[model samples]
Target: MINIEWKQPELILLDQTKLPTDIHYIRCTDWRQVAEAIKMLRVRGAPAIGVAAGYGLILAATEATQSNHPFSEQLSQFYEFAEELKETRPTAINLAWAVDRVLTLVKASISDNAITNGEALINLITKEAEEIHREDIALNHAMAKAGATLFEGQSNIRMLTHCNAGALATGGLGTALGVIRELHANGQLERVYADETRPLLQGARLTALELHEDGIPVTLQTDNMAAYAMQQGLIDAIIVGADRITTKGDVANKIGTYGLAVLAKHHNIPFYVAAPYSTFDFTLQDGKDIPIEMRMAEEVWNFHGIQTAPSDIGILNPAFDVTPHELVTAIITEQGVLKPDYEASIAELQSKVQK
Candidate 1:
């Protein structure tokens, strides 16, 4: 299921905000519509956000070409557009990573005097954006197989996952869900327990639906039931996708991830976070420094406008929470699995990228 697609001149997104039941799609011929889709969670997930952002820039380029604007002015517009899309999601490092990826090519072209027209800029950026989309899918496949190796020799594996980290959350199979698919394919996994993530129910609404649609066995449960499930020894391992990972290996993921990691430690279950290297912010030293996105009070206040609480109730809904590296058993990547002493492991990963 290609959650995000670029059909040249326009960006089409699977409107995840209305998923499972509706199965709707949104077509954005303009960059602002794409940005709005991102802010509204009509298109979401870290990897998906990055991919969508790339296409958003492509859409901006398309519009710029039609406006008869000079190349210099259009390039400046692209820089401005990149910042606007990046600002749509503060927590996900990939949003900026992806947007900058295209801009780097554009910048390089400018330095070489290789591009003088808007059409040339469009060609360069569109190619890079398409490649980003392809690379994301390949990364998902590689990390899925790499992460699944950790559960080798185990049979009838029961895994617990939070939020929506499946295909709906990524450009391809998924990050965490990609590994789950591999395990299922190898006949090692028996079931997945999806947390009904509060405020949005991304788990129940997206993850569960995505898994079920893929023919994987999934059990939907409320967020609060996770502890009891762990106590009953129903969960074998926990794997999730990250929004941002610091060089120290602290992961910022869905708001409930920190509590799940704590539960995994108490039960001595191996906790895993599956993400591509692009999710890592080498600049940031710790998760505490990672910006957490504070969502609307209306989300916590009601169920899609149907009030569940008193009018004007005090609410603090943080979109993400930081999970310390110590709680994580391993960080799975396309290069390989990263073990503890994560600062050093991350340095090694960075070196490979630099090479």
Candidate 2:
């Protein structure tokens, strides 16, 4: 279940697009190949994408090193490669965050003359990428512990989730799914109601697959069924993973997440978001400023390459949507579960990370 793997000079990614039906792997030896994989959804999820981008930079450095070109030329080429990787996906802040972190390290290495040759730079970048991968796993475990506390003294808690935020979606255990795993491990989880997220069905195809393989009880339902399930008292809580979180604690996640949050609030069910600190985009004042990625209409008009609608029909396929902070009962991170007065809480969490 290793979604993204870095084996020395190459990156191996599980082909997420062919999950449940076909198990396949895509090997990336070049940075452009890595970029294409991200664009094609061969490897996705916010944290996973960031980890892939870090390895992509390492691959770029490897190519630059082998060229035997002038140091200035190599550096310029690597920066261009970084920009290319950045453009692969705009909505997931983790992609840009991971790329920038590696770029920053590269620049610092050059300034201090710590990496004079391309070989040395490649080594340094690779180490950083590995560290990013390792830290994600640690963060996931910490977040799971913090999130599990919310269900203390409550047994057999039934939860609802959107999209595929599991081990396949990250470098570690997962974000939202990690919380679910922790609860299951503690014998507090009864079952999971997974939304068959449309246009892609990541929940049905990925989340359910992952949960089933792990022997976790899962019941898949169409996205529209979420509210009805809530009304029926089938769901005790709603937990989702975020691609981006604004300073005010507004969340940008899978497209149907906003609706789920609204339903949760109306039903008096707690709505929670789980993510690492890197998912936070503090520079943005709120969700309004966070960019939303619009995917191709073909994704909606066709199902597994079979036409589901008239080819000429108009379609809007936004990959994500924002949920206002008021609807979120808490935000779970490696630090702890952040409660309201989010602006202050977020700032406090960010400052601690800085220290």
Candidate 3:
């Protein structure tokens, strides 16, 4: 079964925090539930979060349909709810794009007598949301193949990755981790050194589990162990997935990605970011314009309600960090690999998709 799917109460999402040991599902029927899930990382990944928001719209529409509301009234209410959902997480463009896509579809589909059959609208909304999920999975596969070719002629490539950018992170397959999967399938992968991302441990909790389940050889290490591993000549390349990319080619990913980018530059190892074109934000000229989300401070001070640090101490938890364009060797997208002048290349890809 897919991790997130449309079901009765609303949308069914696999709680990612409870993965590897327990598979739990949270049924959400409203935008508040969707916002909470995104904020808590219960439903995560750039692509997956977007999909969740799209489904959230459908769920909200179901309520409107049941109330026997007119199509215009229902759509206005749903659009407002989707806008609120979009603001819950600022780092992922997929969330904004997905919500906007659904609203736009609703506006175009409605007419003077659109409410003639609310049931039909619900079915169409469900179909569009499913398409979002299906398309993301297909994109992951195509990008993985294109990215794996960049590591050609290099046998036994020892890779180091941070956070959970695997099938769990995307609708299916992954972004940067998808390339790692492709390499393993082609017999070029030797080992994967996964960083146990602190505060949340997404790497240890999610990435490691996904890779292990896939029968890939993976080792989990603390975030501090990355530079040490590179210095020991144990790493060949560094790969990561992005939450957002600016027109200037700056990247924003998990909090620890900036440090890894610096270490890769020092070690003279190539660092690559793999993502779909939806990740690129041509509106932002540089990383400075990208808003970094300051998460709840309690995440750093406690784990599952047990205090790990002094209770009164203050903690600043930024969900993501920016990686300079210079540190990234290249970016792998579904269309193909793109270079630093990502502004033009991203525009070209968007143009093609639009046509």
Best by lDDT: 2
Ranking by TM-score: 2, 1, 3
Clashing pairs in 3: none
Model 1 regions more than 4 Å off: none
State every prediction's TM-score relative to the real structure. 0.98, 0.99, 0.95
**Cα lDDT tens digits for candidate 3, 1-355:** 3678877557888998787678899988776887899889998889889888878877767767676677667666766767788898998888988887777776666654544556776776788888998899999999999999898887898999999888888897999889999999999999999999998999998999988988899999999999889999999999999999887789999999999999999889999999987788867878978899998888899887788998688788999999989888989989999886767776777787667
A best-first ranking of the candidates according to their lDDT comes to: 2, 1, 3
Backbone atom clashes (below 3 Å) for every candidate: 0, 0, 0
Give the Cα-based TM-score of candidate 2 against the true structure. 0.99
How many pairs of residues collide in model 2? 0
Give the Cα lDDT of each candidate: 0.91, 0.93, 0.86
Model 2, which residues run further than 4 Å from truth? none
Q: What's the lDDT for residue 262 in model 2?
A: 86
Predicted candidate 2 versus true structure: per-residue lDDT over 3-98, tens digit per residue: 899987689999999999999999899999999999988998999999999999998888877776898899898899899999999999999999
CA lDDT, candidate 3, residue 167: 84
Considering summed lDDT, which 10 consecutive residues are worst modelled in model 3?
109-118
Compared with the true structure, model 1 gives a TM-score of: 0.98
lDDT value for candidate 3? 0.86
